[model samples]
Target chain A: MHPHDPEVTAAITALDLFAGLPASALDEVTARARVRTLGRGARMFDQGEPVERAHVLLSGAIRIAQAGSDGGQVVLRFIGPGEIFGSVAIFTDHLYPADGIAMVGSTEASWARADWLDLIERYPRIALNLITIVGRRLAELQDRVREMATQRAERRIANTLLRLARQAGRATGAGTEIGFPLRRKDIADISGTTLFTVSRTLNDWRRQGLIADDRRALTLVSMAGIGRIALG
Target chain B: MHPHDPEVTAAITALDLFAGLPASALDEVTARARVRTLGRGARMFDQGEPVERAHVLLSGAIRIAQAGSDGGQVVLRFIGPGEIFGSVAIFTDHLYPADGIAMVGSTEASWARADWLDLIERYPRIALNLITIVGRRLAELQDRVREMATQRAERRIANTLLRLARQAGRATGAGTEIGFPLRRKDIADISGTTLFTVSRTLNDWRRQGLIADDRRALTLVSMAGIGRIALG
Candidate 1:
């Protein structure tokens, strides 16, 4: 693997927020962060582990989850390329609150916590970028909370499918298919329901011609209907 | 009214993040921030209003809400003394997504947006502190979202009451009484339920000797029972 290749350099340079930073600042960030790779199903971090760095996804997908007291796991969120993870633990002075695991063939990432603190001290602009990033995530979480409170299970499922489709789906002539690897149980965790419920709901949607489910893949047959359901 | 008097000075100083700033920084922040006294029911800012500043609640309580499409309002959160509001709108580069109104007899607050940016430029420490603050709030929102998704209405009500009591309650011989000036509808909005549901569940708790409803007040008679319900 060309760990120090120019393509990686170009990708990092193209990030809008970091684009304006001087090469020296970027080098400082690069100096403190090390690139790592993980194979499919490999554990990236476990709940209650010491959180020393925040990971920025370079490629592939990661599932962030927390174990419930009832012997089940709850998926908090999914992190894809160009996104950051492990921040909540950094600020709270606690162990990582969730477990992160690779969900695809392979994944690559870079991380820095101590370096980030030093970088923020030297470049306040980075801190401002972080504030905006964290702030947007906060708004998204608030919207999700609102949805959970007000929407029915069917609507929530529809909305989840729409969101995932937008974030990680590949378009086909017939329908858009989500590319990220996921199981029915993972869908249930993310959608905040039971696997049985998720199966039943997917079956109902299939019968209604709203979606086509192939056990391992989901295709949206009627995006407009999903939107209507989400609104309802 | 001593709008910039010792009480306000002490409160602002305790923020720690702002305490070590240079005199010029403090002056800049103070110059742009206006102190306002809001009477009960007065709207601090409405949904879609341009967000110009972030408010620090000096005293009293404020409810932050959004108008639902169905002509109802959803209370997102409540801000008490020492807490900050308006960051969500400020960072998003969007108009206020929710409305903020005084929920008590009166509220005293100070706000500054432009000046705060200047302060961040002057003192990166303040930006770091602000990041920590925003991150903490994000964690709390995640917890609340998880609760809404997993918990039943009765448990939600119980947890909400317990949380409010801890935040802004007064102790009486009978029990801890939530002192915030909240209407039944406000509680319903905060708890993500209809007013009818809130009233019904509260009445059920009262009948079961789990809580005492004192019209504008609420007192927990069985904290253990409430904890059990919340944990379930």
Candidate 2:
């Protein structure tokens, strides 16, 4: 996408980070942005890479994950369209702790590190908006930690589905589909369980008609049922 | 504590959040601050309370935790001197999602919500610093989630103790002592395990001379051994 592309300008303006930024500021951001596209499964950035840019997802999704010492991986989050990531390192030390991989055809507008910091310094409101985003994510991660600590694997899985559905669900005849490819391993990572356990839980939920599960997508057939399980 | 308490003024001025603000702004902050003292185990704020203030821990520590559906609690972090909490609510809808309790006799300086927002608005550098604080915290929470998902209970506990030691430990003859009261329950909460399991792990570690564990404090006798465990 070109800097002057109308679509790019529109997306930048609509971002929560740009919610109240004046048109001149938004224009400057658009001017500084460099758009990059990724094919399905492309690596956006690798774990431990030097942080060079701040990314805003304009379309599609990316999975942020960390590899464990044992070669296992944990999915930190799935960045949907219009969300920001890869900026944390820019603000602190310049190292990406996790790998971000594009889950599908995706486009992101990123600013070189100097440019991003200069933008935030020039328009402090941008930094304020970022505080809100990071703060919210911190709160959500705390909830996830609590769920992993106190809830059973099945309940954790149920709650994870409920959360993702709330964030990315698309209404369909099947149910509220999560409109993204999610593997059993992804559920395992999010729920802090093993893939085998995740597979078993998914099978049980499918048998109970709590979810319409598949490799390509997951549909929550009974949110109330999931909520009941999540409550425990 | 008075608004002009030399120690309080010094602490606030040294905080990264208050960094680079003119003396006038700092003076304004000090004047508007309210100091509160909490005895050991006193709560700074209960979970679900209306978040109406931004807190700065001036002396002692605070434990940030959330109660789970099953009556279990997860200790999100131990905030020591110079750290900030309860400010996330200031930027959002202003509801505390978790409980913050004093881990010891603690003193905190807090700004009323409106006053704090006004200060940040007037001096955008304060807002910039808050973004850094929240951003760093988001990174830490992500690490915790990864540990819970991937590490065994023993490794998780080892990692937790190591982290606490690095953050709050005081060197002592017995070992590198964590200078605060930390019960097995705290370890259990931090490690996402049962108190029974934590006790057993402590006993095992004590037997191996890896730690000097007690009711009032814990001392690491073997940091390298514990590091090996955390590495797993």
Candidate 3:
């Protein structure tokens, strides 16, 4: 809650959007933040809610997802700490298009929409940073669209696992483990496949010594094996 | 291309990116534009090429597509008159991720990357307009991701047709005619289906009096029918 709280300040400074600013500018940004803490499995915001603030995750993970009226969901992205989310809607229509659900106990800082606009106008670097972030996403989504059209389920899942590993993986003695509670539903949603298929494929990979998992986190035991499958 | 050429001046002013600029500012933009014309089936740019210029379509149509190394292609978006393409890479990496291919005889105006940056920096409204455009595309792509995960092929095709019509439709007595030569291959690429599936589905819709088409264009015969399928 305090602007100068060392933990909050450190996290805020680590963000890519604030990368080049001097200490004074960082202080100005830190002062504008309103912090919120989310419990695991709780939503930070729901789809169709009125837009209010632009958020940056400080700690833990968030799944940006949308559910169709017909019941299935798509995981648009998984947000890690020191990353931005919930800002896109502010630039478009003033409504959230997806839910920001905390997959773990997470804390984030948000600036009111008016404040965000003002900051970007003053610190144009922030606007450029935001644009770069969105552009990267556009490219990734284009790749996903191609995979959906051409690749089978196994290849899609393999690609998803490899991508997730690159994004949030941490080194472990056994292998590189994805650093959060990645559920089967998330894997299914990201790969555009069924839950049953996700479970079965992961199990098969486990049996072949390609992966390792516990109740919460999964690790890639053989990145080469997954890469081969993804290539196919 | 003379900056004050009435045709070029009119076309540049009609663009949403230049929506709020004064005549003087529009002249500046027009002055920077280098015009190019494409023959039917010509490529404006190819995937992985160096990003040189940002383009705005003046007339005719272009399909932005990416081809996988494995030989399948995905149509990313169909560009209509006054639409922007090949600019996202300017904000991300300096390489194009898709090929900009003319679907018919086409004309476009482009600005060198440095000039485009100078313009946006000099005119912040242009920056905001660009953000709004990319934000809108992000929303559409999210909805598409959801549909890919949840909906069947027929629904996806219906949605694509409706979206295309809304983007580039011209009203005719028979219906709203898609304002370009939308090929069956384009439909297959956009809808994440096979050529056989797109042709079969279009034939089925034609027999049911849901749509009408000639050699070059498709027209919506009963928008309500297509809307019904899209809703599912």
Best by TM-score: 3
Across A44-128, the per-residue lDDT of candidate 1 in tens digits comes to 8888889877777777889987764533456888877777777656766557877888987544545566766677788888777
> Between candidates 2 and 3, which one is better according to lDDT?
3
Q: State residue A156's C-alpha deviation in candidate 3, in Å.
A: 0.4
Q: Per-residue alpha-carbon lDDT of model 2 for A1-232, expressed as tens digits?
A: 7868998888878999877899999999999999989999999999889999999999998999988666757899988888998888776667987999998899999999999888888898898788888887887888899988877888888888888887689999978999668888877888888899989888988999988976688999988988898888
* Evaluation by DockQ, superior candidate among 1 and 2: 2
lDDT of each: 0.73, 0.86, 0.89
Q: Which model is ahead, 2 or 3, in terms of DockQ?
A: 2
Order of models, best DockQ first: 2, 3, 1
The lowest-lDDT stretch of 10 consecutive residues in candidate 1 chain B is B66-75
Q: What is the docking quality class of candidate 1?
A: medium
Top candidate, metric DockQ: 2
User: Chain A: TM-score in each candidate?
Assistant: 0.87, 0.94, 0.96
lDDT of 3 by residue, B188-220 (tens): 889988789899999999999999998978999
As a TM-score, model 1 comes out at 0.87
DockQ of every predicted complex: 0.51, 0.69, 0.68
Clashes of each: 0, 0, 0
Where model 1 places Cα greater than 4 Å from the true spot, the runs are A1-3, A15-19, A70-72, A106-108, A169-179, A200-222, B1-3, B16-24, B68-73, B108-112, B169-179, B194-213, B219-225
Model 3 RMSD to the real structure? 1.6
**Which of the CAPRI classes, incorrect, acceptable, medium or high, describes model 3?**
medium
Give candidate 3 regions above 4 Å deviation.
Answer: none
